[model samples]
Target chain A: MNKQLVNIKNVTIGYQSKKVLDSVNMQVNKTDFIGVIGPNGGGKTTLIKSILGLIPIWEGSIDVNIRKSKIGYLPQFNPFDKAFPISVEEVILSGLSGKKHLFKRVNKTDKEHTEVLMKQAGIIHLRSKAIGQLSGGQIQRTLLCRALISKPELLILDEPSTFVDSQFEGELFEWLAELNKQIAIIMVSHDIGTISSHVKTIACVNGHLHYHKSNKITAEQLAHYECPIQIITHGEVPHQVLATHKH
Target chain B: MDFFKGIFEYTFINHALIASLFSSVICGILGSYIVSKRMVFISGGITHASFGGIGMAFYLGLPPFVGAAVFAVLSAFGIEWISKKGNVRNDSSIGILWSLGMAIGIIFIYITPGFTPNLMSYLFGSILTVSTGELVFMGILALVIALFFILFYHPILFVSFDENFAKAQKAPVRLINYSLMLLIALGIVINIRVAGIILVMSMLTLPQNTANLFSNNFKQIILYSILISFAGTMAGLAGSFWLGIPSGASIIFTLTLIFFMGKVLKILIERLKRKQKQFLPVK
Candidate 1:
């Protein structure tokens, strides 16, 4: 039996006037690679937001044992005006936001470590250059480095593979696979096929939680989602299976 | 040399020169924050709209600077209140408030009594007439802006990049936002004194855009802005002395030339990089 990491029980999440998620229950263990998949506006992002303490839960309780330093997050909506006057290195260094002291100067050791993380994320070459000059893949990788700066134990990636070319998606998944050994991952993705191999479990969310074990994602579950699942399966004709659910 | 010696005969010219440098420095520093916040448009709205305060000050026989600062600060808060529509959708509301504030300012000026001749300078800039007291006040405000940037550097950076994430980090996000508005208010006040309300946005925007050429970090942004502003100020002062131009207009023109130079430099650098990449072997 593995240690439970996150406990969510009967939680209802909504804004001041509207309820988006109702009575959700989920439990994540140390070794569980959970994928929270759901349709758009089915409270997928809202659930993730609640975990990040971004939204108020109208009812129930969500107890996350991890500290901010221990839980890394890759935000879905990267609204940074690309033309912002900042460097790639500076932006990546912001990942250390979780662990940094407000009044203290970022010391030599912090810089050295940030450089190491940038190298690990494979963006060391673009370090000194402006962030605006980087490609979409490079920016995503940079944000990942920022998330990894804390060396977190639990990683929450909100559609990390979105907006990138398919050719590099495999490589990005491979990199994520390597990181999965050291940390539990809860990826909220619509690319079901890509993430199926990397994650250990799937939490099919449509304002609720459906937990599953194993990497094999069934076409039925994919169809059942009514929106999108965050896994890739090894079974069936891939394109036909996807095309069947397109409607 | 003989032609130059003739210009310094008037004490006001010397005062104008000193005042120009002081005003440029203040605007350069505060404007860096504004541009980085992407709030120049908002600040411009504040500056033009702040004229209502000046008219009110004229009506009450008080210093226009005091009224302008008060009204601009109040308006800044109003803008923030209006921005509560999820931060992303409140842009239209901000746009409406911005124009309405300016309209109110213009109306106040129209209704105010007496033939105020130099109000045009306040509408634009009258660098020559800026007094010693105003210069000192600008210095103090500049110092405050600099101090705020230094002391709250991390929180400010965090909020600017990702406000929601910053809030989740349990950072003083609200305080940071309020502080940002306070800084902007100070910026509007200082800008009015230096460039007058009319050309204040020029002082707020031009130097910062030019500075973005070389700066990557926050401190570098401040340094580059000051340097760029100083260069523009010097050129404008020289132009005013030699070409018999209004110091304010000359400053704005010099700043524009500096921004143009920055664009050229950026283009040249990109071309050079492309050339290097083309000539190199692919891995």
Candidate 2:
């Protein structure tokens, strides 16, 4: 196995005639919990999309140690309406799509593995429920199961807490924290103060890069840093805000 | 009972009815995707493109089903490619191809140097003359589609719901897209005989659209769609026999009547549930 899990070097990612991320370079090591923070449309999602190879790598390279199939990803929003009829288990099982044969039957082991992943994500009860019937938090857990189902070497999530509740967000993060033993995770979030404490690395992607070690972040540095911190600090420092970060 | 048995005694009637039933099953299953993906427009485009295939087959003097399948499949691929490339919005591509395919088809038919016959049957199917070969072909296609759904069930569901997440999982999205296209072509080609170009899209869409209102999941809706499609087709076929009317018109009328009936049944059930909820003690 390669020493570096992901080595994205001098990559420029964009859509047609619209350059989003420029000269982005990042090296992900083992057990790295990276937090990406920036404003909306600031190429946070774009950078993640490029990493997932959703868009073409226009200028440079994004090389993962293993095959593209081994990576797990969760998007900011699902591009589907409630009309889509898929069970949570079915949706999660698709994470192992690349590993399974299209025509071959799924075995008992696959079912057991799916159940185990669901249990890990705290959505075992939702295994039988339709994904459309799930609450936002439940949906997030189901998607997490999908990301973890393949035992991915790297897990990438973009704005995971955007639609989830504060309590669920913390629980979700705590649940994600358990995977720090085996998988490297890259999370895109605007919840800077809370998330930075849990992560080992912080990446400020606002059409560029401001990568730093996590514990190095400070309120003073944030006031000057590139992330959207002004909108975050709303007047007097509430105890819950500080506690959520430190706890 | 005697009258029904008398009708059943004829091999032609049995063959045609069975064939139509098989076609309905495939349409009901495949049509739900057609409706959900908002690919009604694409299916409409294929309806027009089938004319081109029909014309070419007549000119070349070969099996039009083969030609229609080839033409429809190629157009399906083209539509898939254009949607993928994002060159233009889906509507424009569908409109352009739809019209061009028809014009070319009409020109081919007009230049054939003889009086055109059986054109109406192609435009609007004549159920009176369905061959056994066509019936078998439809059965095989329906089975193949059903099997395809049974396997690779997850990826198809994922891709249909959310392509971004599907890609994140590195699913064979393009392959799934192609598979869907191929299945759509299979559905159309199989039914292009019993259902005409004029009324096929309605037969494909109406039942599933109606069933979608009543069911919560894909499996239930699919089962409902198939049952509903079968009912409508059978009712229409029976109506056509009794009234001496056009089978195509009869089939579409059956679907329309079923739609209204389904709405009535749904309203009654909803009202009953509300009344029960109102009367019941709080939990």
Candidate 3:
């Protein structure tokens, strides 16, 4: 059965007075791997924020079928202060935080779970290292482990490849593919060529949403959907497929 | 030996020692959070804003600490509320409160009809003059803060590190933020007696920065900061006694000296380890 995880209906959201997303409609199923692509300031991040309930919607509803806690989120790679004194293990374990666990200490089971997630994420060796000591890829991996520690039913990653190396990007996609067997995934990225090959469907968001059923999308399709993004194909001879400009 | 003997002989010295101990514990824990969360500016604003309360209290013939506490808490909450609204720039709002509070304080003090209130104690601190009531309050505050940190350690860490992630996990982010802000305001006001308003920010940040050089672990930094704070306080007390200097100024000077020393030592240790590593044979 295709279990519906989230349904966004006529969703309108934005910063005050400036609408970023309007009448945005999208449905995420249990096994759906959605790649959200849009130009900069094109409301892709706003759509996700609305879906995550981080911002208030001006009009419409976003229904999350699963428990809100079961939706793990990996926010965009912010340039965090390198001097922040926190260990990788501590950062990962923070994922287990909830109303129930607020006053309680992290027990042996939680530690064991963190260890297992770190091992799976290949960050077990760096558990004791502070986040400042880790490379960008290592930090991304640590955050990935944190996003997974809750055993979430749906994972939301915002430009996970932004600060990572190519090697880690490949590994991240592979890991995401493996995780998608059991859970749904919604990834926002500007790299159309890369994400198109990995995602099961595509959502072109530019003030609104155009949900494409198939991962394969043409430049014409992107232009038709009003998503202005360059498509850089990877091959022996790298080429760029620029969307048709109306102006 | 003389200092140790003086602690047993002089009641003022006894009060100073107890005040140092309690203030260290309170500042050490809150300082770690302040440094990690990068809320030093907000803390400074709250500290300065409390001066308004002091001035108002002086004018109204109320205890300065009471006025300071009320003003500090109100400004802290105001800053928190304003920042949440996202209407004004965070730093600009802080600047407004910081200067506004100071201006209000000066105005109140100037208008007061009594003999000129001695502002030195409030501005630069007089640790030796700490009262028994203040000591009791500090003791209770230390206990409460310790209990709060112990019980909500993980949640606090989670929220401090990444507020959005904590919120997504259904953590009480708002409650924790407001509670910590209240605690921070109270901590700043109480410690004003130990380190005057001008030097209190250093007390909250210097030791934590020194500890950060040695260990990047949050808990370790807190522990190290507490120890370092006490040592600096003691050393500063001794220096103040010998040099006939102000206790608060001496304490801040010692802490700054310690921070520089720690930085140099960290550099030396790293160089030594690098040199040693170069001599090792390849595996």
Candidate 4:
């Protein structure tokens, strides 16, 4: 039996007395690939933030079995000062900083490991380049390498493909699929059809959470959970699946 | 060169030069963080808030630096607190404290009975009149900054770059942030004697921006900023000596000039690289 990685029970999350998520429960196993989908303000990010302990719970409990460093998080791309004077290699090498001593510098082993991860991510050539000079795809790839460098058992990615082009987005999903084989994954994205093919389970978070056992979630089921977004499916029909009005 | 040799013989000139070196080193190291973290506004707030302390010191017949340090540290923590716990936005809080401190300084200076000391020096610096005590204070601060950067280089980098990741790593993110704010406050307080209240913000930003044009490595930026800051200070000091102008204004002008030159140079190099690429045979 696979070990339980996260057991979130009867949890409620909010900000300043306003509740964003209520009565959310989830169980993540050792090898589970969970795709979290919902409309923009439907508490998907709030749920993930609660799990990462970035937000405080108003009620109930969330117990993460793994240590903090064992869980890697890749936040959505936000534009910080690009000319802030940091190299791609240094940015990725910072991933191992959690494991090293606070007072110690990045040791030789850290550099070697960063090198290996850079090579794997196909960014070894851009290792010495400034982060400001990198393309969007290169920055995303560099961030992914940073996220994976510490060998996290559970990786949490927030809209990992929002900044990349479609070609690189496909490759990123493929890379995440490969990484999922060894580690549990929680990917939060608005692209439903894209994640449906990759994740083992589907979680719809809209104030409350609706957990589907498989990735194939129907429009009726999504509406039953009160999630308002339309899911577009590929194939012969290629039609938008809309929720039927009950009233 | 002859001007420097002639000035180097005087004891007060030597003190001024040493003070400039120490201030440049600390500013280079701490300035990198301030610029990268975009805390220039906070530094400015602290610099202005320190004026209150200087006024209080004048009113009470105490050393101005002591009053400035106390008020600066309090305002630094106050700004952090107000932004985090209260409803005031960070920038709004900064603006409030900035003007309030200056107002208090003006009031206290007005109330003092004796003939008011030359406030112009404090307002725009009198580097030529730097005392040994101020030099010692800056020296200690420079040493402290160097040790902090050396010992906690990676952790501080992680904290500065991606704070969420640092928190996940269980790094003391809050401690680092608060400590850095305090350091910025102290740094601004000590630097007041060099660039004074009006021009110290440039001292904290220009060298870092100039170094950023050449390299992005944090260590390289610090080293380069220190060198650049020292060179600018020397040149400005000499300029002020020859022109009979205020050292603080001259120093800031020199640094700003360097910043523009660096920008132009970067554009030229980019254009040159494009020309080279275009001239090459088609692949």
Candidate 5:
């Protein structure tokens, strides 16, 4: 492994008094692509939240080698107020909030950087359009631009392909694959088949972390790791292990 | 022309006009956050809760504004604290404080000696009666709000839009939230003089809604809100003066009219565009 990006040791997270995640340990390296898979209520999102410092850990610690701003996050699609008057350019520019001083206004260089990122994300055409008026694919691309504009060392995505169509979903994963050349990525998802092809390793999260060294996990391995999720693959199905389901 | 000339000659009219302009500008800037964050009900709670302080001041024979300020700030912080610390939803806390403040105000007013002071002006504002000192205070508040927005636009925008993302970026989300709540409280208190507790929320939201019809940028909305709100306030003032009615109700009604007008115009323009597109030949 290269430089360690995040080291979560025996972390526990919960809301109220019920323990949602308990004693979860995971290590992320600089060039790692980890796909976190689990059941619906299996602490997958909680683990990501703990890594991003969005929720308080009850038992252990999550230490990050990178600065806070150096960790980029693309959260799940929570519907926004349709009447809010914000443009795509302004939304992307706000990604630099952590990089700049509190009172500092965005300057010419910042605008140029935003423009570059917009072009790379293929959202330059929608830059001046209202965010509410954009299609789902455009909004997803815009959010991706906002996450990448700061040039973070680690990118965490929580179900990045939820609202995305299949065409854009492939493109989104391709972009992430390209981005993984430089930084680390931790993607949490319930969809295992599509994620298996993109990630370098797999981690089964069900209140605890089970690190699988390879992307391909057999049905026996799934039972061994105690991960209850069923993997369903499409197309010619080159992989045979996925077809070895006992259920 | 005669009515306009008669109104311009009075110093009170000048004070009312200036106060109206200043308050409208302040509301335009901060109201964007209130609307975007969906905290209009919380603001409404603070506005009414401040009335508790007003009643306490009446009972204790103190300056009503000072008492209202103290109570408004406390209730604002209190709402935040209870919602965060206790096993209560935010709307529940807002509901608690909203009625608690009103009850406290009524009790204090009932206990106070002598006939109750004419609170009609406070309940339904009399902008023509606004004094020079009040106008100056409004002006200072407008400046403070403008400076705050100018300096912290990025973080405020990020936090308001996506607090989780802002937290990951270490954008001081809690500090921004607290400060905004404080500003909202202060804004409600000051605006009570121009638009009473009953009608003040409209002052905060209607102009922003009207502005949304024209622009989809946050900064542009603020600019348009200020212009639209100022226009509405001026028209309301004139209407109130000519019709011999209360200024607060008139201002709110005028803004409502503007909101409907903007909605109708937008629908008409969209229909026209659709018609034009249908008539054009296929490529």
Candidate 6:
């Protein structure tokens, strides 16, 4: 089996004349867990959006070995209208939607699969509940189930840890680690400290991408990479403010 | 009993009842979509814009509903296209179309020579005077909307809930959106005769909101909205006859009353549930 899932080459993307990412290159392979860390508007989301075909790239090619439907995506939370009158089960089942399922009713087999995914995500009890009634963590889990329902070869998540509590965040990384054993995973996150412990590799995205072969990245190395994000470490001390960096 | 007897005795009353049923079916189905997708403002813009078409039709000596349909469809597509292009803000574009359409309508009506057309019936509605041709058209629209919803339920629901996710899934998002917009325009035009232009939006919104108070399921909301809208329309018709009030205003009043009642009932039920939960043994 071909291990390479996606090969993004020299991709330049932007929105309306303003280039967000320039000459970004990355390779995703089966069983690879890449933790993407970047500042706000640092082309992290733009890179993923280009990969997902959500936006057009100005220059470069993204060659995906798997079909588009084979890549599962969990977008950032809170952008969706919470009061939308859709149940958790319905949201999960929508993952199966594509050109083929447009006119077709969701089958019993599809529903059974949704239930199984919900059970795995530990949100089966919340299946009948509306999305508005869910806690942030529960909503994340629900969206995770949606992303996984397609049985994708590659799973792409955008800031899955944001809006989730610490406990669920821990649980989520554990789940991601487990999932990485089967499918390639590309996750965008701001919590580099937590991500460093879980991910196999690290990619620091600013205007460009600096892919580190190992997950263990030092502040010195991050500075060398020109990635200006602060490294947040947890300890008994209330907080440690790092000295301001010179431009 | 008098209402039932009147329905049989007078053809106009019979027409009014049929018109109410068709209006309920059309408004209920489309209203659920409008409210769920939060397109009430856009729909409102389209509603007002269609008046421009009505005025133009009056000036040209064509049927007013035909002009309304053309104007409504154009404005609906215009708003969708303009917003998609991202040059102007969505709300700003809506506002432009909303006022522009109404202004164009007024200007045309003002300039049209001969006896001034009765604007009250078009603005407020005259369901009691609904014609057979209008009823047939409404019946067809109701059938078409019902079929569209039934056949494309999942696509519609998915698209409405999360548009980007639906696009990523490759669910024909553009086609569904444009088709629905077209239907919305046509639905608005056909029902203009039932509730008139001014009172029509309430017919499309109030029942759906009342249904939403009870259920958060899209399908359930549609079903409940249909039933609630029908009940409201019938009750409003009776109230209009009894009180000698305008049918359109009375219908809207009744729908608003029903919505408040549903709201109060929901609060009561929630409070009762909380009290009952407190009585349960602490685990």
Q: What is the lDDT of candidate 1?
A: 0.75
lDDT per residue as tens, model 5, B187-243: 888899999888889999999989888777889889989998999999998888889
Docking quality band of candidate 3, CAPRI definitions: medium
For model 5, name the residue pairs that clash.
none
What digit string (tens of lDDT, one per residue) describes model 3 on residues B50-76? 999999999999999999999999999
Clashing pairs in 3: none
- Of candidates 5 and 4, the better by TM-score: 5
User: lDDT tens string, model 2, A1-247?
Assistant: 6358888999988878888888888998878899988777778888888877787888989887766777888888876776566778888877777635455566788889998877776788878777778888888778877787778888898778776877777778787788877888999888776676688888877777877765345565454444577544434443321212110
> For candidate 4 chain B, which ten residues in a row score worst on lDDT?
B1-10
Candidate 1: the clashing residue pairs are A192-A231, A192-A232, A193-A231, A193-A232, A196-A232
Tens-digit lDDT track for model 5 on A1-247? 4899899898888988999987888899998999999887889888887887878889989899989888878877655665566789988876777845477778898899999988877888888897889887788778888888789899988888877788878778888888999999999888888888899999988776778778876666666556764665745444435333222
> What lDDT would each prediction earn against the true structure?
0.75, 0.79, 0.89, 0.85, 0.84, 0.89
Ranked by lDDT, the better of candidates 1 and 6 is 6
Better of 2 and 3 by TM-score: 3
Considering summed lDDT, which 10 consecutive residues are worst modelled in model 2 chain A? A238-247
Q: Model 6 over residues A155-240: C-alpha lDDT tens digits?
A: 99999887788877777888888888899999898877778788899898888788877877666666665665465564332332
- Backbone clashes (count) for model 6: 0
Error of 6 at B72 (Å): 0.4
**DockQ for all candidate structures vs. native:** 0.38, 0.52, 0.65, 0.52, 0.60, 0.71
Residues A129-226, model 1: lDDT tens digits? 87778888888888888777767778888998877677667777787778877778889977777666678887777766666666566666566766
Clashing pairs in 4: none
DockQ: the better of candidates 4 and 6: 6
State the fnat of candidate 1 relative to the true structure: 0.38
TM-score of chain A of 2: 0.87
Off by over 4 Å in 4: A234-247
DockQ of 5: 0.60
Error of 3 at B221 (Å): 0.7
